[model samples]
Target: MSSTIAPRVRTLLLLFLAVTGALLAGAAPVSAHAALTASDPRQGAVVDEAPAQVSLTFSEGVAVSDGAVRVLDPKGKRVDTGAPADQGANTYAVKLHAGLPDGTFTVTYQVVSADSHPVSGAFTFSIGAPSTTSVALSDQTAGGGVVGGLYGFARYVSYGGFILLVGGATFVLACWPRGAGARSVQRLVVSGWLALTGATLAMLLLRGSYTGSGRVGDIFDLALLSQVLQTKTGAALVSRLLLLAAAALFVAVLFGAYDRRVRADGTGEQNATGTGDTSAPGAGSTDGGTGTAAGTDSTAGTDSTNSTDSTESQEKSDLAFGLAIGGFVVAAGLAATWAMAEHASTGLQAGIAMPVDVLHLLAVAVWLGGLSTLLVALFRAPSLDAPVVRRFSRLAFGSVAVLVATGIYQSWRQLGSWSAFTETTYGQLLLVKIGLVVVLVGIAWMSRRWTARLVQAPERRAAEAVRTPVGAASARTRKGAKPKAGSGGGDGKRAAQLARQRAAVASAAEKRLRDADPLRTGLRRSVLAEAGVAVVLLAVTTALTSTEPGRTEQEARAATAAAVTPQTGALSLDIPFDTGGRDGKGVARVELDPARVGGNEMHVYVDRPNGKAFDVPEIKVAFTLEAKDIGPLPVVPDHIATGHWTADGVQIPMAGSWTIAVTVRTSDIDQVTVDKNAQIG
Candidate 1:
């Protein structure tokens, strides 16, 4: 009835968790997914000259994928000299050719995040001034939507199957009731192994396509597969495949030992049953005609055979026990592979995080996988033993405790702040996962309650055993009936009636215990419900694993702050204009320092429609505040450089959307105008 976990069990669980965590840390990647934090030649900046190199800094370490970074000129021509090289833990740099002229050049990048997810974005910067002809980012390098979805699905399958195979086998060997669920348990374990194998193979192919061109044909491309194998992700997957192969061998040994033990026990049971019949008190007397000497010799032979059978059964059981232990050791090492390759290994305080993550994964496998196996047992079992239910209750309690503790730490590490939990997509998804976990825990609680009831039901039946002494009394009455019948007819008739009644009562009780136990039925229902909820929990967990954590998003926003910070600058643009249907062209340049709600100077340069500098008869500029609906302030400019004009002491009130229009007249019959919009801050 005690709800508290025992100190000894708690201590042992903690030790196990700690040791597993350490082992997992050694193989973990020790990083989180990367997000771009800062970039050199900041986006939308008006630089005086092109820099020799462009650099990008991320929230975590990253690997450049194919076509990872490309710098394009205004005309959309590539200008980057080579691949971007990692300058530091989180910085990547790309060199640019000398004397590069740029007008709104775009830098598009695609990199594999530390956690192996693909991330991409584009930004623009200009030399001298911004340009209307900005370069566009290409979609050729982007993964196709359907292929990406398939890859994610494969990842989910791999995780689920891996947990089930490891956890189910471990639970069966270490915790399942003797001689129960032999075939079903083996099938569960084998199915898990097969599922994991299929998922891993599918993932390898899907990953190749996902990281490459995302074409369906790429899934079978040997060239792409060879290239993918060279990367860290591919290596981790390959390692998993090898580990799974070893696990298959271990599983076979374990199962073979189990089969030997079962067969030995079965033979022993048959021998014991045969011996019992021969040694029955009434049977030996009937066989006296065969001769007393012969009977004694037969008994001796049977005794010797029973002794040898007992010894063989013991040996088989011992062998099975040893094989189970070895299997568990191999599974632990295999689980460590996942911890090493996942986000847990790459995040903050990786040494500590990796171990905690491993423990977390271990807890998940134990709870979810065990529940799945238990559910199967419930459905297939005629009558689940109370002892088995009680044992599982304890195991589940310990596993959930570990899960809760590790989950809190991971949430803090990934979210950084409470506000992020509400503000970011990753945080929102995490909340969903947490909510699902809570539901699963509730279902688990119900299962535990049901188990407690089941254990109590047997105790209740023991009390009922005292109330149902008819069977025992009937045996005594039958033994005394012959003597009593000799003494009196009435006594013999009464004994007969009592014997019949006792037989009826005993038969009813046996039927209830063997075929209609209500507690077993209820326990089955509860376990089935818990298993169903666990499936949903796994789905949510998969989503959480795929999501980008809020911490990365926060870092990205901080890194890009400079790009949006307001600064005083002039708006300069070159507009090509033609008037009077002539091939003549003109350029307009506007200069406004402290381009805000204050006094400023405005300048413009113009040429006749022909590519010649010709003084215009008249030139005028107009300003409008579109958002405020209050502008059209016209200003006449005095000629400065023949075709060039200048205006000073121009006033701009209020900071908002503003438009500037320039009108020019080459002669009485030739005139043209152009307009441009700018944000005044």
Candidate 2:
């Protein structure tokens, strides 16, 4: 059995790894929750003059750090005059220095989202005309680089540990009380506790680096760690550690005190039965003269038996009640840590979303974790009672119901529209998870049916026992029946022999049920399959937490609007040229009045290296829309001034990136052609 089961478990694990790898490889780059939707001056726009301040808008609220918004000039030097200020409505503005140079500038920002994830990005906007810039673009973003990968892995570990810890304990307390004494169950629950504790500590140590610098070395930085502890995420992780300490005590009681109590209770019951059996014959064999004394002894024995039973019953009730309460508090507390610091705390209807998220997490842990515990018990326990499997079935069914209710609410809150289901990464991943869960549910249903059959086996056997012929009983009595020494019809000894015969038959029936039960075997296979799919589902869920929600993506798109629009005034572009000849280098200033999808006026000026007007032998200009493959629309401009040319009715057919090719000839043999891209809108 171990050989067969080992191969199956290995296969399932391999499949899980392959599927997770594929999903991660195909998944879009992980980004922070809050998205930069729009910015003042517009990205890559060339304005006639610089604005007083640079403003930015995001899809959600954010907290700005000191120097969070930095504006750099063409020389890569900071140009922003003051710190960033909040302008409400999820907008922030940073004042720029007065009289800024006429060149491209880079704006880099780093802010914390409301949900405590860091968001960072950079954009470029020109003052008068786009020119060479030395400002390097920032590549830092939330959940990117080596630190992010480690943090993400830690998150997965934490979730896995949470399931094992909660599910194992709940199984021992609610599904199978006797399992507490079993070594397998004891190890399962204890390992869960250890995993959760270690993962929590790892998260705390990595949080500072994850949110600040993407450097692995920064994880040990005392300053960063101090700052992290002051934040909400830090507080939550600390709270989890404290709760885990409490959980450790609970585990000790469960496997130590609780296991001993269950074992002692079983032993005491057996001893009580043996004592009653031995006392019964003595009371019956007494003479009539001592009838009163025998009656008193029997009464005393009856009272003692009742007293022991009552005490045992009360102890069992008290222990069960205490475990239930302790388990719930610890599980709920651990779940709350995630709810208060993740996507649920920032989105729409967050007040209601947080609690719903907690319930959703709890339900997932119970069902998936419980399935693992049941699988181990079924395979290892010598004689697992059918009642334990039945109890877990009911538990799983209830958990699924809760999952459905809370899942729908969460989906609606995050998506906000049906189209998002197919259009966004978060929604697409959600669909995949839903599909896996459906398969898991089907497998669970099959397992439930098998459990029902297993539970009915005892009843069927009892019915068969009742239907046995009277001749069979007579045969058994004739084969091994012997009257005891006491001669009064030998009724007591014969009754004892019949009781022993019944016990032997029951033991044989139980043995047959354990060794030859097809239902148990079927249930184990179904549960194993369920667990395999559930592992994949959990991976998808972890990915979803890092993905940007569909509603936020949609809102960001709407806020940014079109990338280009018709210019209200003449747009100017400075294009530099060198013909590789003596005194051939010059700058061309091209102007398009009202650059849009229609006819527009244009002007071109050629200036020498010393900023003086210079005359060229010949000049030519044409426009091409490379995206649409429309090309080489020639513009014949007549020379109106030295180093100047003008044209009218230069038609632009559409809105897109258009290449303006310029040809200049300083001499017959010295000529060059240069192309510049311009947005025609």
Candidate 3:
């Protein structure tokens, strides 16, 4: 039977892994959650001239790493002068090299958001004209692949381990004290510990690669490991590892000391050696012993009973109290490792959210983990106590209440708005988890009903036994029996036969109680169903951590206002020219009001190097769309002031990168034409 069941269990485990893989595959990519709301040079804007520095603004605060911001010239060479500096208000700026040449320049950045998620992206802006860039643009906006999958898998395993360890231990201590001596219970809790420890180590090793370049080789890099240890996430993992060491001691005490105590207290049928007593009651004494010997034995037995009743009772109470305090500390510490580093640590009302989240995690571990423990006990224990099931039912109900209350607060804090429920991935996953919880609750309700019936069975049986006559029970047992001829001492022989008949009847009744109890069977089935739904719910919860919170996404969208359209604003350009003539190095400030695909007015103010008005022999302006091979459409401007030129009805026929050429003929012999790029929208 074991061999046949082993294969079926393996197959089901494989199927579960396949389903988990598919769900994880559908999760949002492990990209940084922070959004880039705005930037200096404005993404694709054509600056009149290169600025000394470039700034990026995010929806949340971000930490800059070495070379977090890089500026690349059109030739794909680095032009950034220094590292990025945090300018506050979720803005960071990096200096650029002086005298950056005319062409489009790319700005790439990679930073860690306040929430410990890595953010990376790139943008471009033109200097003089929109020229074709030779810069090789590699996609670095998101980081995730093999390393990410492994990290994610490790996370799921850690959660599973937490549930098993916390739940199994709690079940043994709080629900079924006798289970402390059960091999199945011991193995379940130990497996949880091992799995959680291993998964934590895996996460530690994979963190660098998962967030960096998504390389497998980086997992072993000591340098990367050092870097990881310095971050919040790293600190949390290390703390968890330390707590696990303490948990190891706790597990030892639970299975070793606690189990022995429970068995010694006679809570479990088996002794400390896991063997039942086979000797008949009072068989060790000899009937031929003297009265004094018999009296001595009676006195010793009474003293032993008193010693056990006093000393053992106090010891049990002390041990249970210490275990309770130790377990709470270790469990809360483990939960803190998550709440301190994940979304709960950085979002709004984080001070309140962190403790609430820790409670939420603990409640899940207790309810889901306890359900798993109960299901295993129901199937494997020789004689599962009805009281144990009742205890767990009460515990589960409390856990569910805590889950509901904490879940509502967390949902509101993470989502913020109603529309986000449908618009955001985090909210959708949350909705799925809630639905699973509801289904699980319904299953638990059914299990509770069965538990109630199971608990009442013994009472009902005892009542029936009291109402039935002993003579009737004996007559029923003796039905179809034959009376043998009496030998010497026939009365004694008859008494022995009656005793044997009663023992057989009691044994049969116990068997019937076990095999014929439909309520116990139904409870097991319902608990199993609850555990199954819980596993899926856990998967969804894991996915939610990877996905961006809806509140952050909404905030990002809110920060990123609508772009300025031509109808609402105007385009201005400062074209610099050096005619290589006397007093010819100056700037021409040109403005196109409502620079759209229609007729517009143009104004140009030519200033000398000292910012004073300047008169030129001739000033000519025209626009050309180089991508479309369009000719220079002339915009004839008449000199309206000493240094100002105005042109009415300057029609920009289409929207594109239109090169505006300005010719300032300081003299007939010395003139220069400068081209400035403008995005006409």
Candidate 4:
């Protein structure tokens, strides 16, 4: 591999990554259940009749599998209701076993939103007389729109950048093998380091977003940061991962420097124990040495004691090279894991408590990191010498062992029941990944067999060379070199045979050491290719870990839609929530029934003499969104949607408080209508 990679090959690697980025990048939000329109018995309105059952209705259908509604009396006594089920696609109902006992009742329920988030909200409605005591869900806008958007965008970019960096570098190292202008393979290592850094920053940003931290400006503001940090669900998971990453980085820096020193020594062996003397008996230490006996087995064996010292020096300079690769894989997996988790569950605990996920991550890192290290060695090894082969084989074996162990543990953890193997997505994908790993192991085994075979060949040849030629030539030459005086046949033939054997052994030894032989090069490339496949498999594993292990259930309940909006006396309020028609779109339409619920008297006010548009200079109107910081838009029209916003469409853009200021200030009375700003799709 070359130090400077070719532009085209680099471009292709980058292009592939860019595409993967697009796949994982944030798509538009999907529309989920809209905000609660109106709860029957209207908050606090006491009714004389005892209802048979309690029901809650929404703007859209509630997912029955993950949705539930509960009715509680003021004393916190639960009312008996047949399993709370979705009455209509949009209405959730639970038949109460007992009725009467008015005071105040609270309907608390949670729904598994289409976006995969478990969202819960409660509303209080009185059974008999309305209660004065009431409660509202507390909400705070964590940050400004610009800050939040940048935060999410930065996270995505970091993830893309990390995957691009590692996957790209590894691809170059394995597939392109010194493509075009790259004079050496070191460039891949450099690229890997840069990418790992990008991933670290990304993970950090991800933590910030999920935890709802606004900015560094809020770090010292413990009240704010703590709010984000103390959140049991996301906070623990994000914090632990951040700490782990920081620890990993610190280790990487230290080990990277150490790894360089090892490479710089020019020994060609990572753990070589040197004897120091050039003419020592240790020359064939591995018995057919590469690094152990510096010049014993490589093509450059006779160059000088530990001759490629400079080449080793270069390896030492490449710090964090392998770790960079590991970091990339780890980061990509974590991001995908968290993103999907956010989609599927509400609290972070559900996602974090999945021990299988943690094991899956560890397994991926070991496999990917080990494969990268092996690949670098594959290119650097000058020959298929036993010592070099053994070293790599040992390292490869360790990685394979860890991968197998972690994989098995993960499988057991995720698929607890035997039937789960074929029943769940987690099971099926795990099987596929496991099958691929088996194949990879088979290939590695074959390589190991070849290396071991090569190790025994030299001694076999040395013995044959000494004995076979002598017997053959003597059989032929005995007749030709026969002397009348019987010229010392035995001694002379023996001497000649010995000389030939010496020459044969020397030739075999010479062949063993050729630094640039085609056969050696081919073997090196082959091993490299094997390692490359190993790395790719690792990336795939990472992807798998990030995916959800199940398909959403299709069964839906009976649904009913109730259109409700705020009422300011009478007039009419109509809203067409436009979720830009595109991927990740989230559109909301709030239509107030009659555009008002009450407050309209039989008489007329100054806002409008008749039930017509009141001609006023400006119709000052203000309304509050149920939740602050609406968060990311869901796959469906959902309240916790990201990039949430609200705006005035018509005359309501101006800010102020006004009451029935009906005046013909505007030239046209029809132009006095107003619209509010809603969250962007």
Candidate 5:
């Protein structure tokens, strides 16, 4: 135990360190987001006259779906600015009706970033009075951080750690009871748990780019939380993952107890010695290990041996191991279930990633976990005997086989073609991993065959076995006295039992004679080999996941979408020529029109085809301009009710373009936008 246990522990630690370092180093960058660029009616400015509108600009494209701005009076009463609309992808604006009654106004804005994250801020300024400049706007944003740094650590370790502890550990259980090239259920369970926990940490930190706020609580905000809950795909996924985790723990408790209790069945019994008993089942029951006599000391025997707590504790570990395994497999299964859902991609290449990823994760568990077991066997086993070596060989073989098979399948699906294996970052990393696995497997196979042959040649080959579990017959003879007097039957029964016991004894000795020793020396070689190989694979897998798949393919998809998108100049428009009452201010319409935007011409029609026949003959036009920032702005004049002629707000300053879109809607034609570019000189 001393010789084998210590080395294996060392191997595990080293391997773990290697994998950790590799993954961290290989992580990629898909992070960038909307930044506040500028605002109209700049913060903390005083003016003699009232401006008609307020607007905000961002560094990148932004959507106003979750965006709003409040202008409050010094008394904190909200002054209504017209509804904000998406003038362009990154711009939002609202108009104020008449002149503002001169006082301070505070403008506060909360906008949703493109990735759906939120940003909020506020500022105050005056219009004609000092009171207007003193208005305080609410600055609290929607998102919440998980609190202090210590709290964040606790949150991640306690919350995120528990997920991996349960998931990875349970997954290991499902992959356990190892065989050659096969991982025990436990290996996968543990890996899944750890990976998930790690991923959660990464998501929290990385989510800022996607969400626009570097806050944990913000990810769970009203808007963000709603998206998760309301989306059919999102809610179902999260709920199922949680349920699977819970159910695994539930089942693990029971399985763990059962496995632990039943585990000693083959080795815990003893036969009465000196009678030369050789029965395979043995004569005395393993219950004797409790040191309480089964027949003679039965009355209070159960109470004295061990306290209830110790027994319960052992049973609980078994339960935990069991549940972790359950959860792990279920996670893998649930991941696959997503592929068949309606929301999943359904094309030939559709739904492949979801299922393939689950399988790939399962393989990672088996390969990595199996490597741990190998290291244990080589460096930690108490005996280097033949049977133990053989047992390990079988387990190792099964693990490797499964690893290779699953890996190939995953590559086929994920890579799309053999060329992708070299072309894409993800595919190339996978190839490297496969290469490492081959090396590890080769080393193990060589050692396995070498030990098996030595067992046959060296009589009394205990060393060949390499940490074999104690045999049943040996355990029984260690029990001195026979538990029974008559023992169920007469002399005939006794003789027959004695005869069987003798045979069992003889067989155990013969087998032991053929087993080899110091199997650790050979196993150590394999364990080190596996450890090294496992390191490389870990890095490869991490790098693979960090990169985007097929950039060219994504581009092709975009190109196709563009082909179907609406093109300009396909539509024409027209509107009525009259200047309605209120002193010649009304709707004026025009046929085919192209509104220039920043020198780029925008095709506009009266909501009709560019070449189509239109209604009303002539169109009257009026224009009004509103200048923002850069001055005590005055409203420009306009004539007649005219929707036909474009209004240029070129009077606005602050290094940006202003847009006035011509909306032409007659009793007949559809509404269209003829957006004219306005540059303030």
Candidate 6:
């Protein structure tokens, strides 16, 4: 019972690994960052009056889909026109109703990036002045809650199913032990196929809902499903279902129908043997009277057994060859569908990228699928095959190597900089995946060592052969000891009894040999532990797929750094003064616009320390290019208000340092000039 149960557990594990590997293989490509770079009325800016329109600019080109952008007033009611228009290249704008009240408003947007990933964000701006009655908009989009989780889980299920369905069958036909086809093993393969099929269909509906309303109830929404069916993602899933159907035919021929044929032939051969045994005595007794009849009967039985064996072998070989060819083509098609719809196909050199991704996915499936099947075989079979284990070890090593190579290319493509490893969320997740993979490899090393030990100890099989249940041993002993009382006389019966005693002694010796081996027990434990860790590694891989790639985040940051990043904008300062005169202490404010080689405005305002306006007799402002031969350009300001004065058309001629001096003459005898340095870029 323990032996029977062990294989089932391992079979289930293999199925699990297959599903996980497949889902991870189809991970969506990470999208570049599409940050909001600029907006009309600017984020958090207070305008003197409400504008007729609101506009937003992103770091990258954005596609407007349903609910792409919304404008909400301070009352949280939407006010922008229903449709948004694209302005220039990356800007989207929507008109506001006439005469919008003076208050804060929020702009919320969700746009699809060039890589087909959604980027969402929101910001707030006010009219007249900053408002206290407005609600704070979130800096980032909200998560997709329970519906999103289900979608992810469904993806995991689909991937695992594909791996198990294809990889498991391939392993059994190509590398499994010749003596290792238990009912449980067959069931495991069938279960995987069914799981993949069901998961594929489930994903179709879930995808529609996820992309549309992102609500759990939308899973059954037909309108969304129809819309989704028109998308690339939907088409790929549909193709997967069709390929799975074709694969089912291959599985039926290879593992199901062929297996039944083989079993039927075996049963026929067994029946022939039983018939020959029952008629043997009668033939011997009548041999003298009918020698020809007995001879013909014996020859016919031999001929029948030989014929059955040869026919069954030939039929199995032919069917297996066909299954292999058909299965490979079908499996490749299934893998292609996933590759075409994922991130890899959308990126650079997609023609080559698609095949590489497919190969990477297939290799991963093979390794994980084989490991799962191998673990089951080890437990179910009495003795492990040295050659089989060695072959699987080599195969696993090759798969890991391929995974590493492909993974490197993918990493380089996504994370264009080393800084992304620690800076981006996607990069951090990748680092975690790498760590887990390393640990899994270490465990695999231990498993390889056990395989080596098993190879060296070929005598282990001889001992395990007799480690059958005690009841079976006792029954065999009884059957061997018993003799026919009325037939063949005492001499024949005595000879048989002596032979039985010898056989019993041999069984006891074999049992003792089995009991002497402790390494066999330890090896089983190690393999099981290794399998546990491999499962965890697969789980981490799934997580990696869901996360955004570091490369995209870095690209987005670079783009934002390019746009909306001013070369040189405005600079201002407020210099305080005291002239040792009554009511003379005041603040002088100085401003420089576009501190560059262009005409700029310089405004000066004077205020008393107690917040009242300070009236000065004269105000003068001047600028001198520092460390250069340029002299000070003085500007006599025209008073615009009681405390405010401005001098327009002030010029900064070159890109260099400059000094601005503001002089406030309250009285002719009490005058002070405040100097400040500025850089023109």
Question: What 10-residue stretch in candidate 6 is worst by lDDT?
Answer: 24-33
Better of 1 and 5 by TM-score: 1
Off by over 4 Å in 4: 1-197, 203-227, 232-360, 380-389, 418-423, 453-536, 550-681
How accurate locally, in lDDT, is each candidate?
0.68, 0.79, 0.78, 0.43, 0.45, 0.69
Identify the candidate with maximal lDDT.
2
The alpha-carbon lDDT assigned to residue 473 of candidate 5 equals 39
Q: What is the TM-score of each predicted model, taking all chains together?
A: 0.67, 0.72, 0.73, 0.39, 0.45, 0.66
What would the per-residue lDDT of candidate 6 be over residues 83-151, giving only the tens digit for each residue?
778875367888888888888888888766543345667778898876655556643232245555566
Better of 1 and 5 by lDDT: 1
- Per-residue C-alpha lDDT of model 4 across residues 441-538, encoded as one tens digit per residue: 78777677766665554545544654565556655554564334445678677767865676676555544453334444554555655655654454
- Compose the digit string of candidate 3's lDDT tens values, residues 68-168: 88999999999987778887556788888899899999988877777777788888999988888888766533456778778877877888789889998
Candidate 6 — which pairs collide? 18-160, 19-159, 19-160, 19-161, 20-160, 22-159, 23-159, 414-551
TM-score of 6: 0.66
Tell me, by TM-score, which candidate is best.
3
| Root mean square deviation (Cα) for candidate 3 | 15.4
Candidates 3 and 4 compared by lDDT, better number: 3
Between 1 and 3, whose TM-score is larger? 3
CA lDDT for candidate 5:
0.45
True lDDT of residue 576, candidate 4:
24
Cα error of candidate 1 at position 567, Å: 10
Tens-digit per-residue lDDT, 596-621, candidate 2: 65568999999998999989988888
lDDT of 3 at 252: 95
lDDT of 4: 0.43
Taking every candidate in turn, the Cα RMSD to the unseen true structure, in Å, is 20.1, 17.0, 15.4, 22.9, 15.1, 16.2
